[model samples]
Target chain A: MSLVTDKIISKPKIETRDLGLEMTENNRSLIEISNFDFFYGEKQALFDVSMDIKEREVTAFIGPSGCGKSTLLRCINRMNDLIEVARIGSGKITVNGVDIYDDRVDTIELRKRVGMVFQKSNPFPKSIYENVVYGLRIQGITRKSKLDEAVERCLKGAALWEEVKDRLDTSGLSLSGGQQQRLCIARALAVEPDILLMDEPCSALDPVATAKVEELIHTLKDRYTIVIVTHNMQQAARVSDRTAFFYLGKLIEMNATDQIFMSPDKEQTEAYISGRFG
Target chain B: MKRYFHEELEEIRSHLMLMGEKAVESVKLAMQALLESDIELANQVMESDDVIDDIEKQIDDEVVRYVSLRAPVARDLRLLFVAIKASHDLERVGDEASNIAGRTKKILAQGLPIDAVARVPRMCELAINMLEDSLRSFIQEEESLAYSIVGRDREVDTLNRENFKELVELMKSDSANVSACTEMVFISKSFERIADHAKNIAEEVFYLLTAQSLKEVTRGK
Candidate 1:
């Protein structure tokens, strides 16, 4: 043991480095939000929110109740506009480098490019085939052959074709909770949206059904830049490439899914994920 | 409910600590058995291996249950995972201790002069100290100490290598000393592996603390 050498050796110690908590760099940002502030009338809901959601990647927003993860998600598609007092107090949000709030922008056309799924699988009381083609129909796609093709393609894309193909005429509500969610996904896919915003899409689902939607989310990311807001950290970890943590309207941390779930840079993010506190 | 999960996490830590204590005891007992040529103590060390194995099984079962039922995340998730991982390494350490004890019985049977194997006990003490410290780091959350043990593994490896080199020279120098010297080399090898196990525990503690693999963090360093 007394044999000594000139080779320099440094002892390994777990040093606490100043882990830079910021938006994780991606190859490209399909949607970039910079200093975006949101308010519901007098109350500011978001504070200088900034993030880059990459192209054709699943990015999940996770936080505790009232963390405003959902609020930031709603900004992606202007879903917050439904609230009468909702308004952007500062900064800009751009989808594909175009300001979504531009006067020249068409909100309906923007929605067509950015389809959304909600917490509840709100499939209209229509036939399964009707539900899948609801968006196309709204765009005035009346051709039966075109609608028929869209139904098969989108349902298959959503992993629901094998389950619901036979009962094309069956009411959308007739499907199970998981199947209903998949149907809602199919309906969103039918419009060929470049971005998909899912807000707690599996909160009302059973495990098996939740798994199906999660699997669908994995498959859907190849074609759409998906942003999902999930209270279920496991689901977000299971489905997304990147994850963003928001707390009390502040963007806490965003990194690769494994990084966020395993060792988040921020103590707040770790506490929230570890269930220490929210 | 959250308190319950943390309690389970604490329970797993306690189990690992118990397992670590037993495993470290085996190392100390095996060293004693080798130095004193005590056949009874060697056999006792070998027989008690089942305790470590049983604890390993319990940790595994509890981990599966914790993962499936609790759905742990972040530090909670890392703790559960590291519990299973560290227990496995401790079990291996137990096996190494048993192997050392088995070698002690062989050396004692040959009526070998334990003086030739004096260096092996020193190595055993170093390895045992590292093992005990690794577990202490985990139980006490002295995270830096655990990582320091990881870096110290290189010293163990060097000692084992140098001892082996010296033993092989002794075997070649005198035909009569070949058997005992060869056994001494194997014993040194076992100590090396035990030190490796200690290093593994240190790595697990790093992951348990930071949710980052020690190897990954140290790779750049």
Candidate 2:
């Protein structure tokens, strides 16, 4: 109990970013949550969670089942708003310094800038080309050249273009499970979201398919900040630059991925990583 | 839920412990043979080498299977990696013990004065002690114990150097004792390597426990 191993890297202060005195990447807090709490009707699911998701970096959340990792990711782009029982209790979550839970913040608009991919590949039954551009079409982008370009670019971004380019007219459901997941990722990318949240994107795919997604994640972080929630600890270690460990609704630790995997600071982190946690 | 994965890790630990005891015993027995000139004991140490090798081979295979199955992370990860390297070091330690015993075979055949070769056994005692402590340090996950074990490496090294000097002086003064002196030097060198292997395991234990290399830590006097 006396071992103080929680040697996480310190978060940057908001004032430092505002004043422009500490403008280094280490001091950048792309998404900041301060003392945030959430509830599902009577039961509180998150307790005073405060952490930063840096710009253009993949931050993975890992923990046991029902540890609120998915719950926390849902709160980022207001994905939990669909659940009638869910409610935000207190505190502030700011993306680009604007409080997301504010009254004027449209959930739909917020989701546009923060794309998401789910555990299952939920690609629409529409054709693969249509699935890629479905978001843009709904937003009223109708130009043939624009939709065609978006389809090409996003499919390539997901690394599915070469395999599916000749079959663009085929139903999205016709593709293999891994390819369908990549199609969902392309759909998410078509919106040009600054932040992408993935809730166990590779959970349903085989190892070969999983590797493609992980490799895609590695490249996607250069243009968009990504946060992933995965129970797969090795996948989290492989793709993310930083890792956050959550347990029992609390943010236990956040650190560089290697540090988290090789020599984490918290005993709970150690226990979880070592498969000793009960 | 207690997964079978944790059980696999425990199995690897137990096997490593068994190998540790064998490695330590090999050195002890070989040292005894060197001091007492018991060719039979020397032969026993040599013959037991395969048992030590087999234990290491078993642990190596178990570690590989554990990693392939669990893909262990953090401390479990460090434990697997350290287990692999430490097993290799333990195997080499066994080989050195056998090497020392092999040299003792020659000394017995030549009928040399065991006194001139006596200091090497004294050095083996420190090396054996270090190896024993290194194994304990790993089993207990004691960083401080491993560090203390690392610091003792210098002592064994110093004794090996001094022992080598004494044997060289004996060889230079008496041409007839040259053959036995040559075997004594080889034994002294093997003892130094055994001490090094012990230090390697201790450093590995430090890494396994603290997740920091012991050499990086500022040692105390």
Candidate 2: tens digits of C-alpha lDDT, residues A1-278:
11111111122222222323123254367789899899999999998999988988999999999889999999998877777788888888988787877655655666777899999999898999999999999889999999999999999999899999999999999999999999999999998887899999999999889888887897898788899999999888777888999998899999987778777899999999888999
- DockQ-based CAPRI category assigned to the predicted complex of candidate 1: incorrect
Segments of candidate 2 deviating more than 4 angstroms:
A1-27, B1-221
Candidate 1 deviant stretches above 4 angstroms: A1-27, B1-221
Error of 2 at B32 (Å): 36
Kindly give the stretch of ten consecutive residues in candidate 2 chain B with the minimal lDDT sum.
B1-10
Cα distance off (Å), candidate 1, residue B220: 49
Compared with the true structure, what per-residue lDDT tens digits does model 1 show for residues B51-165? 9999999998777756743567898888887898889999998998899899888877776644567578678888988999899999898889888998676777888888888
How well does candidate 1 score on lDDT at residue A6? Answer: 12
Model 1: TM-score for chain B? 0.94
Supply fnat for every model shown. Answer: 0.05, 0.05
DockQ of each: 0.05, 0.05
Model 2's CAPRI class is incorrect
What is model 1's DockQ versus the real complex?
Answer: 0.05
